[model samples]
Target: MKTDLKLNVLSVGNTSTGSRSLPSQFAEPIRPDLVKRAVEAIQGNTRQQHGSKKEAGQRHSAKLSRRRRDYKTSYGHGISRVPRKILTKRGTHFSWVGAVAPGCVGGRRAHPPKPIKIWAKKINDTERRKAIRSALAATLVKTLVAQRGHHVPPQYPFLLENKFEAIAKTRDVIEALEKLGFNDELNRSSEKILHAGRARRRGRGTRRKKGPLFVVSNTCSLIHAVQNIPGVDVVPVHQLNVSLLAPGAHIGRLTLFTEGAIERLEKEKLFMQEYKNLHPPVPPAPQSPASHSKLQNPSNTQKQSQPTQQKTQQPSALQPQKKVSPTKAPSTKSKPASQMTLTQLTK
Candidate 1:
């Protein structure tokens, strides 16, 4: 006997059950652990590296000194009376051992080594597939259960549906949803889908392209769409804490076209237009003169006539040039503090 799991078509939130109008297979109970593992695996696969810090050793040079000599006396003093045996260099003091002579103690190391993780874990194929399926099932079930029993804001809905119409472009997606019996008003902008949560890969292909999608107006429509597709999962954007939407029923493409839905869509468009008007205009892109040869060099016909050129250059020619005087530089005689101004003395 084919073991029957009544799967509470409605309780499961499949479109066939009427909770959501999307695909039907999504209306089953999904395991949370499986969903979590699937998400983790995807995240692991998409993990980005900081890239190696090959220049870290060079950065350490800024923190340490680079002097070779050790004594301060090496720099000739004003007086010759100082003993030649005195071992001071120009920059270093008597106490400084670094500059005393050729063979001296070395300075401290600029950078020290630190410990960090360098390896990532690889998830098994069987576990990944199981997790994705579980997450989708959980999402649909939660939506069906919440529709009547629990109340939440329409704008901040319980689940965020990410539909990939299999048919490319946004218009086709909207049409598909309408055909599935959802109202146009129920559909939100594509931007909302990105904000709510990102789409998860079905694991078969690395390059999964989104055709066109929008949020389902009713939970019934949403579940139906999800239940149909394999490997796809949906969960409430705000709370990853709950169920997942399942896909296996092979639900067909959806579209929206119910009564009064057009009016709602117009209002949404108006609101978007008004919001766009409030934003400042984007500045024009900077054009590269070198890339366009015509822009760099003007036509000879447009050049100023010889008479006009002479007129423009006359004033510049007549202007008297200032002669830079060869004033003798001041001798290096030290002035007494009393002779200096208050500012000079303070400095």
Candidate 2:
């Protein structure tokens, strides 16, 4: 008789068992009702923390005022005087204190101050603990034995692998995990986890000494796309912090799938960057005539052409001056001859 007994080989926060396969115990039949109940129980057990008391209610209070008139009447003429029927009238035995109105000095208070309303919602201890455990158990059971291209039983289901860790900022960590066959199909929301938290001192500088961590999100974006094997967390490894990576912080053991995915992502990223650097964008061939002109007429070319133009202008000006001087010489000679002829005629 082939009997199916459940085995617990994978321990959370423990070292890798180095075994590639499940211990055959997780292959037992699944109970959908049990899983549903577990999900409900886990959800019901979640605890939401409350804010500060001062922030819970409005601080400034509204002010209120009150005034009242006395019913008893006092009699008076143009001159001050007490009426005969007044409480303080002559021969009246009533006390003056009793006749005083409420809210007056030594009188009873009309309205006392009121307290403002304040309330808060809180979670119970038992429910919170139960929820955490149930969620973990559910994740563990589904990830261990499920297979790709096969119907995943609730007790032993596998998830398909695709772009589960695509959104991680650290490509190195994400690609490393993808190379390992440990992704699972859990229908929940997915998210990219960032690295932030307390640091622990290692040998030299401060480091996240808590070992490693895996983050499973409640996002459904990559749930069914990846081979739903149970071990891959879509989150990057470098983003985790010491507090989150501490012993007992995560739900299961840290596997090489995560490490391998990160490595692959790093390599791919490097290769892409190298390819981009090696094949830089070629500048567009100078299309504008203005740019071409600027390049061809560099400083030396401009200086050479300017000197030649100046030399041509200088020769032209000199030739015109030389022709004008010769014509002026002939005019001077003709003027002297005309003056001599006039002198001889007068003699």
Candidate 3:
């Protein structure tokens, strides 16, 4: 648990509202193996099942006999004892030709498919949840997001305010993202990729890039606003899975979360089944019980030790000169006390 890990919260206008500590959901270790497994399972479950017709070619008569005294027998004939249809017959004599069998006309299939076959794959609930956490953690890393071909600003890993969920117009959303320096990312995700294969014949060969994902606490108008944007997806925070978090089993999907969504994830323990006990929620602060790791303080209340610098300037009388120091600027780093203003028991 990175109790000191704080991220700046940016509004839709690209201005920082305040800093917030990341939830325990992002504290998980990156386990690519589990992520890949979960993605494969999801892919398997989504596969459309199909097979050949049940009774493709079984509508012909091809019965034959090897008896010498029978009416339609192949006895005393030079042909082998194979199933066939009788073309013409005489008393104790028969003329026949092969039919109604594999390699013959109108014969049943050698091996046909059945609809009963299952195409879905199984994954344990525990492993699935762990994979989700791992993927979630990967999203906060700047290098991974950049390596995945996403255009990230300097403040790549920032949280979103609840105000972002209220935008209901695509034009306004694009305008807000532009203000945040995401024009390049939007263009990158808007391009169409054409693949050359039989899938093209089905009119589905063209695909768009997978871009930013918006996770909200509740269903809002933002879902409808970003629906038509190429490669962008809006999903409820509770519905997060390996597929959305890490598309095609690849890590580092650029994600945006509303402040309410972050609180909900922590308060409800959304994707932390295995590690839920590891970082048990501390006693809720008297001001707010809706907050989880964000609103709590460290157990040890000892003050942080500050480093002091000793002056080594030689103010000797030889030159009778005193060196002047430039004015120092205040530190921009946010402290735990400053972060308390973000979700202070009120929106």
TM-score of each: 0.30, 0.20, 0.65
Task: Output the better candidate (2/3) by lDDT.
Answer: 3
lDDT of each: 0.35, 0.32, 0.84
- Measured on C-alpha atoms, candidate 3 has an lDDT of 0.84
Model 3 per-residue lDDT tens digits across residues 1-347: 33457888899889999988877878888999999999999998988888767657654466766777786666777877557876787775666667756777666667766677897899988999999999999999999999999999888888899998999999998998888878899999999989897989998988988989999998999999998899889998988899999999999999988888888887778877633553567896575544444446543444677798997987667786766899999998655765667675355
Stretches of model 1 off by over 4 angstroms after superposition? 1-29, 57-90, 93-119, 144-172, 179-189, 192-347
Candidate 2 residues lying further than 4 Å off, grouped into runs, are 1-120, 143-169, 181-347
> Among all windows of ten consecutive residues in candidate 1, which has the lowest summed lDDT?
250-259
Name the lDDT value of residue 302 in candidate 2.
67
Q: Provide the clash count, candidate 2.
A: 33
lDDT digits (tens) for residues 1-347 of candidate 2: 11243222222222233323222222323334333444444343453444434322222221111222323322221222221222242442322322122323333334432233223323443333233333333334434312212223332322222233343334433343333322222211132233444322333332221211244323333324332323233344323321221122322223222323333333433212122343579897756987677788797446655444444545665465654544443344344555677666676
What lDDT does candidate 2 reach at residue 126? 39
Best by TM-score: 3
Sorted on TM-score, best first, the list reads 3, 1, 2
Residue 247 in model 1: lDDT: 19
